[model samples]
Target: MTIRAWPSRRLGAGGLAAGALALAPVAAAEALYVPEAEPVADGVYAIIGPTDARTYENHGMNANYGIVETGEGVLLIDSGPTAFSAELIEEAVAEVTEAPIRWILNLGVQDHRWLGNDYFQREHDAEVIAFEQTVRQQQAFATDHLEGRLKEAVQDRLAGTEPAYADRRLPGEEATLALGEVRLELQRTDAHFPGDAMAYLPEEDIAFTGDLVYVDRMLGVHPWSSVQNGYEAYQELAALDPETVVPGHGRVSGMDRVERDTGAYYEFLVHEVGAAAEDLAPLQEVVERHREEPAFQHLEHYEGWHATNVNRAYLEFQQ
Candidate 1:
């Protein structure tokens, strides 16, 4: 993970923009679960959550979120899991800067990424932005997301989270957003979910590759993910030549980590597993052949997810 020098001049409550629209204080019990924000670049912060599966202990905060200072106000990349998590994220940002969250771009359709939109929009009057595809997917999968693993893990913590869609929708495959001095180029691709997207800071050379890049953890090839498309999307991200990468789920890192974990792993799957499937290799043989692959064994959840990834890739290429 890449760490940078912290910015000086921390702001107090009076520094909040929008007439000091700071959220009410969190209860003492929820204070303990707030994730701390770490500076990754000038006026950019990342709240690195746990790399484990969602559970009661972690309160479904297993995905990372980003805080970017846009000079005028703050821009949040991904909102947290629930209303409480959003409050916690708000408090964490308050510790770093007094700027209120003015704009939010949900990078994907995952439950944790946009579920907090309701709170931010209602409280801070921030404009929630997402791709048109993301909002469609969010509407389509709201129930399953609420009742699936998230509910099973977080239980009561899932309360108060509403299905709030984006207030502003960016259509098409690409768009550019300029907030104050910060400019972000948004690109949507079929990588992790129905509407997987990434935000790039051209001037800073920072890329917030949400789910398109994972560091210190193995990327999952879900039933909907396309290995071929994922690799192609990775190539597009690499072409940008970003100096820093804030992945969807892990610590802030450089392009090398993104290449090693996500790009190379996807390349391996498409070439090796795709070849095995083309050769009519049996499923067991394919799984066994790549079970001990050394390249990504050091990543968390490798043991649990690698085989499943191989299996999914093989199935994908078999057709």
Candidate 2:
């Protein structure tokens, strides 16, 4: 499948006010059922789900997740955002291999990243693991921000789609996961928030970069994000020089695509947005001005998230 950007649906009349949107948690993406799972390596498979909002149509499966067979059992990448997605993912994996699933590993810190934990815990007897920071981020931001957004995002899909957090977590550093014949490496990325972790499987020459490497999409940087750190993270990921990259969203890709596009986006944003904020350009003014720019004109969710990214960047500098 062609790697494309996710399209965000329109919000209600006037939407939430700009201020409300700012303070609100990340709204989810939309779609239905699980997409196909493609093999990244010999025994590894991934469903590179959409990067759109977790609305009804999207089925709360916007974030990508993967599977790796360890000769002993199966090790999953990030679980999807809801019980529905978790069910679809488990079914999808069974379609390929009958091996019991051993674990669900998280690649990002967003609430949606781990909400599928309940499914694996209840159905598969699997443990959901994430970085320690991922757990703290959930406790710090989940209770207030995510639950309602999830309730609104799922709608009727909310029936059995309970929110689940990571039951086990790794420290915020380099750690190797030994799953029999496979070894998965995990770490935070500079390209995304400090809490964002990218998983690398050196034996297979593949790295599930998670949201750290968004391919052909408008990435919303947190207000306190650092482009420089992103630059450094890219360098670190590039050093891995993997043959396959299972991004948190978008289709699984090669290292070359990750090196070229994500870095360019960061460079452009840091310079242009950084300049505008330094010039004391108000958030709305900067957003409007950039809306007229050529660089982001063709991006899939440009109208929806580009301005929001600018607004977040501006707010960071303002603070």
Candidate 3:
């Protein structure tokens, strides 16, 4: 597949400056794009991309959706980006749990969190949970980015199957659930994306980190994201010390792979960006230069995202 870069159009000086000024606001737009959902753990599950959410904007990327089993029933973390994908997850959950989907925790406020509520509410009557900031991000995404894309995504979800949605609202910093002998913990971390959260199963030594950890793919950054937050988030991952780390996308890997790969990407970002900044290279040029780095060589169809990540890194370094 041909990879595409994040679109950024520059106007004349006057317009260019205005557009540049608007970068932060535009970057803040919260769009949820997820693809097909999949089963990750024995009782855990995930969906990779284009699920009921816009996938074209972020270089056709998708957020990962996860499901954890609980004693009461099942707890879903971050619904796919649309109603149809949510329906698929619901089906998957049903296979594992006869009880109703009791709690739905949105790891963050992106469309991946709230867009599929209609399905859960209508079908299984699942109650959605999210951080207060996550709710705000969802509102921002709905108002700023979800209009056209959301409609298309929702329609796409409804195309081949019955329509669905869920009931949703904001949640607290930490929430716990019991599923037989397993205990699931949903904890918030201020990294990667703002208001990001993780699902931890201490018993399994497995952690579901949304976009916070990318196994082999390059991480995304925006003008609104804090470089420190990204760094600190990595540190948090180091602290969790999970045996298995399931990223928002890509294959599941050990904690060592998670730490090494994530750290390598960040280190590459800092080093490369520093060099580019020292020479005062433009973002586009910097992106082109590192398009073939060894660290990113194995990513499937990654050129488009590599350029975008480079641009993001340049922007982060500038700040």
Check candidate 1 and list the clashing pairs.
none
Put the candidates in TM-score order, highest first: 1, 2, 3
Worst 10 residues of 2 by lDDT: 1-10
> What's the TM for model 1?
0.89
Compared to the true structure, candidate 3 yields what TM-score? 0.71
Which wins on lDDT, candidate 1 or candidate 2? 1
User: What C-alpha lDDT, on a 0 to 100 scale, does residue 223 get in candidate 3?
Assistant: 54
Top model number, TM-score: 1
Q: Write the per-residue lDDT of candidate 2 for residues 83-129, one digit (tens) a residue.
A: 76567677778878999998888777665567677888988899788
State model 1's lDDT: 0.84
Candidate 1, residues 44-118, lDDT tens digits: the string is 988888888887766788888889999899999888778767877887888899998999889997788888999
**Positional deviation of residue 225's Cα in model 1 after best superposition, in angstroms:** 1.6
Ranking of all candidate structures by their lDDT, best first? 1, 2, 3
Estimate the overall C-alpha local distance difference test score of candidate 2. Answer: 0.70
What Cα-based lDDT does every candidate model obtain? 0.84, 0.70, 0.61
